[model samples]
Target: MKETDIKELNERIQKESAFVDMLNLEMHKVIIGQKHMLESMLIGLLSNGHILLEGVPGLAKTLAIKSLARTIEAKYSRIQFTPDLLPADLLGTMVYSQKKEEFQVKKGPIFANFILADEINRSPAKVQSALLEAMQEKQITIGENTYSLDEPFLVMATQNPLEQEGTYPLPEAQVDRFMLKVIINYPTKDEEKHIIRENITGAFPETKAIIKPTDILKARGIVREVYLDEKIENYITDIVFATRYPAENKLKKFDGMISYGGSPRASINLALAAKAFAFIKRRGYVIPEDIRAVAYDVMRHRIGLTYEAEAENITTEDIISEILNTVEVP
Candidate 1:
């Protein structure tokens, strides 16, 4: 692209992305900290992918998603997954209506535009698998009828990191369906102090519905048009390829640490996520920084850690960091 075209695109992006500021201001009124978490949620929504949130309890994980749902004109549902949760519970079941003399298909909470799967790990594999299926297909089958979910559908799931006694770990295949796996931490003392005062005063601000559902759909279309260079595409491919063929790519240090690497979906998500990050930054073209900004979330849950790496206290983050640092930027 020419310099003049690039300049024009950037200007257009700035004009279209003005709502981002409004969104940030409204979200901050209710949320004290965790800026990264908020941005990741927007990215996932814009990219049309599900997100997995890992954090300790009482970190405002639930509140953040709730506040976000309130800011947009969309249907929101919060499903509390427990030990007794069933597939029919997550996905709507068919109930026979004697008056109608037929089975009526009732949709579940998955039909909403935004879903907060609170404590998703508390459920069994059957429930988890059902949710993931809806996420991947963007629709669900009720009895003999298949229903398509509404557009702009996003699932933001939260799971406690400290508890494993009653939790069921997500299978690798199921976890791979999520586009990003965000790890959130506690807030700073200053932010915490502000939170305490605000909670006690009963003067918490609320986020108005700033954008319509169509606005978001339009923004996503713009995000898809964002420029991606051929070199940048190759860069994304190499990063995912490194995870699979580390030794061949001169990353022998991680050869034994990684039992499995990212799949092709990782490459696709990385490119889409990088484009969304660029759009958020009001840029028309994706740079290496855009890719780096989202690399952790996109690749974290995709890699499988080896027994040797686990024995040595190595984590998927460590492997991802190394891969990002070693991969040459175009």
Candidate 2:
């Protein structure tokens, strides 16, 4: 890309940055901290992918998604996953109407634009499977009728990592369907103080509507048009390739640490995520830095570690950092 092209792209990116900043401002009203978490959510929205948020309870995971849905003017639905939650409860069921003397398809909460699957691990695999199909295909089939979901469909599922009691862990296949698995940590001392003060005073910031669902859909279409240079594209491919074959890529530390690396979806998601990151940053063409910025979130949950690595207390973040350091930049 030429300097002139870069300048033009940068200009466009700056304009888009205002829209992204507006979203952040709205979310900041209800959310005290977790800026990175909010950014990952925006990236997921721009990239048109689902997200799995892992955190302890009371981290504002539910509040954040709801606030975001409000800001974007999207329909929001929250499903509290439990042990007895049935598939029909998630995907809707067929009901026989007495007046019509025909079976009617009553849609569940999953038909909304933005759905929050709260404590998703609390549900069994069978229940999870119902959501999996909808998350992947953006549609549900009740009896013989197939219903397409509303446009701009997104599932922001949350899971409690600290507690496992009576909880069914999400299968690896189900986890892979999510584009990013974001981990939300506790707020800082000052942010916590702010939260306490706001709660005590009954004064909370209000999130104003920044963009409508239509605007988001248009922005997503614009993101698809964002350019990716061949060198940067090769760079993303090489990083994902290195994850699978660490030794070949000269990532010796990762050889035993990782039993399985990211799949082809990782590469594709990386490119799409980088474009979204760039789009949010007000750039039209993706750069190596954009890929590096989002590589961890995109690859963290996709990579599976060995038992030894787990016992050694090595985390996916550590492995991702190593891969980032080891991979050559374009």
Candidate 3:
């Protein structure tokens, strides 16, 4: 927490962040233009939290994640969730093995370090629940035997907004488990032009591994060591508390804007994400700016809006901005 310690930690974060940046740059070769989405994914990786990405099809959601896995030298698996997908399909089930004379547990794709839950909304609640224990507890139980996933495990799930006809909405409880919900938008005209040129000319960019799984673990430790001052901690607490009781803070703008506020998990994730954001920015100690930078992603899915707010077309982004402006920073 001291200035000298902060300086040392900052140096360390900068070194690790360089590695992360190198990996991202390599991913950019195949992925066109999604700088914001890529940054958020890195933050999620640094914070050791799951990400829920919402975007239209062909936006490179899956490609970005696959490229990230390649850069990190981690095991990657993609599960295509469908309406008929079953929980046993995702979590794997015990099969009778006559040779072994016992039921053997077949591991599912969830065992990988980087799991891409593609079209997550297409699956029903039962199938989605199959990921609950793995996402939250970092372990899975099958056939009375529990297995802990390897370190640096992360779930990067994507959902298509344009097609939701038969999809099951992710419950708030499940949504809360995700650290951030990133919205990937269309690319700029210039970026799209570049994308087309590369494909037409057959000039594919190659990606090389920049960091190993061990490096990710080291970065995570560095993130945990980042300091948070008492004043800044109080500021974070106040912001989260305000969500539960908007009237106490004279937040009339949020009175009809929210039906349910964020949970304790939201507060914890916010703090963790703030630390990661600071670490990514080459800072050892979290500043008010770090919290502000990640507030929307950390709290958007956690907060539920009222019917009137929905009818008025009020979004979580708008409400989060209001909270940021209303809350006095320390």
Find the candidate with the highest TM-score and give its number. 1
> For residues 198-311, what per-residue lDDT tens digits would candidate 1 score against the true structure?
989989887789898788899999898889999999999999999999998878988888999999989999999998999999999999999999999999999998999999
lDDT over C-alpha atoms for residue 217 of model 3: 92
Q: Candidate 3: lDDT over CA atoms?
A: 0.88
Of 1 and 3, the candidate ahead on lDDT is 1
TM-score for candidate 3, please give it: 0.95
After superposition, which runs of candidate 2 have C-alpha atoms over 4 Å from their true positions? 1-13
lDDT of 2 by residue, 1-330 (tens): 577766776676677557898788779889999999999999999889999998998988888888998898889999999999999999899999999999998999998888999999999999999898899999888999888999889899998888999999988878989998888899999999999999999987777778888888888887887889999989988888888888889887667878888988898999999999989888888888999999988999899989989999999898888878888887
Which 10 successive residues of model 1 have the least lDDT summed?
Answer: 61-70
Q: Higher TM-score: candidate 1 or 2?
A: 1
lDDT of 3 at 190: 98
In candidate 3, what residue range of length 10 has the lowest lDDT sum? 16-25
